[model samples]
Target: MKIWGEIMGKADDVMDICLLAGQIMLTYGAETYRVEETLERMAKSASFSNIHCFATTTGIFLSFEEKKEKEDLMQMVRVDDRLQDLGKVTDVNQVSRQFVAGDITIEEAHEKLTAIAKAPMQYPLWLIHIAAGIAGGGFSYLFGGGWFDLIPAFIAAVVSSIVVVEFERHLKVRFAAEFTAAFAGGTTAILLVLIGIGSNLDQIIIGSLMPLVPGVPLTNAVRDLMSGDLLAGVSRGAEALLTSLSIASGIALTISVFL
Candidate 1:
């Protein structure tokens, strides 16, 4: 009975670790297939023969076969928080591989994941704002905006970034934040043109829109579809579509009012 109890406890611990790892990957914008693969790898690493995992955009389900028990263990985890943090995803993948290689124990892997989850931004806040401005400026120039147009595009991008960040912090909704950013970008571009600081209003607006594009989600959606996760693919595609519409709607509203 004592040995049986120990085995059961270890089984439970392994389940928790696998579930938590899956949760982290799903929450950090990993594709459904990648999440499932990671879970399978973790279970295989622990020498479990019967393991099944199903992951969607919003949740994950896991089942493990018990060694000495009659009933199988099952767990479902909900994933709500999502951000475009590919760095964290890469970090998690490395950790997962290391765990599978037997370089770390389950407890150590859990600790590393917890630290990664709580990790701070690699770049400072100001640096991100600067990068956004530079990207906007570069795109504006590439889109045929004259050298003078870069200045206004840069200013517009910085303003849009600030508005989006502030709104997202307060509202916790991606749509609201994106819409607000687009409106601010459009309005700023218009103001720059009115003040004679910008040479081309169209170029400025187009350039500023670069920062608001949902490139990652759109790409991930296509990848998911190719990998045979139809549900997650459709859901993610819809999300990307809605985000694009929100941006367009905001820009259109601003243009109607000002231009």
Candidate 2:
């Protein structure tokens, strides 16, 4: 009787661990398709047969097998965090997963990540001006415009980068989009606003904004790649590059009437 009870108890603990791990991974940003895979691996390691995982944008649930056959498989869940750290770590998503894996508490991650996230992130206006001038002037020179047009090109780089920053601030403070959409939309909106102001966006594209926008993602991807998050780093880099192109394209479309 004693032996049977001990076996049942160990089984229960395994189930508990699997269910908790699943819930935590979902919250950690695990995709729905991968949730079941994770749960299966966890359950097998935990030594169970009844393995399943369910999830939505809003929730995650899991079931595990044990010695208690036909018993109701348990489920565990938790609420979202009101506060979270969004810092630039060498491996961005790994921190989130580590936080979920019981390796480190959320509070600890938040503290460390907060510090990194708030770190100084800006390029001085003078450099921006020079970069923009070079880019715009070079493009103009390539396309048969006079050297004087480089002035507007320089101004364009400065303006575009500034607009991205300003737009990013509005999204963070007002609308609350995170790094991805905020970065993309912010750059886009800034260009739009410039066009609305009658500034030549074509010159801006030739300007230094490309360097400004690419810096963050490039940094983030480097961080991820260094952290051994190859997939994530590549994805972020691709996203950054694509977003930069999108902004340039948007500007081109808006001003194409002159061509």
RMSD in angstroms, all models?
A: 1.4, 10.2
lDDT of each: 0.87, 0.49
**TM-score to native of every candidate shown:** 0.95, 0.37
Q: Sum up the clashes in candidate 2.
A: 4
- By TM-score, how accurate is candidate 1? 0.95
Report lDDT (Cα) of residue 99, candidate 2. 49
Worst 10 residues of 2 by lDDT: 81-90
lDDT (10s digit) by residue, model 2, range 1-259: 7976766776665555444444444443443344455556655654566667654423556776564554446665652421111223233345445544657643455554454444443446566546644664466446554555555555555555455546555654212222333243234434544565324444434443443445545665676667565665676578567765655555554445333
Q: What's the true lDDT of residue 105 in model 1?
A: 90
- Model 1, 19-116: lDDT tens digits are 88788777777898999999888887877768899998889999887655645778898988777677888888998999999999988988998888
Best by TM-score: 1
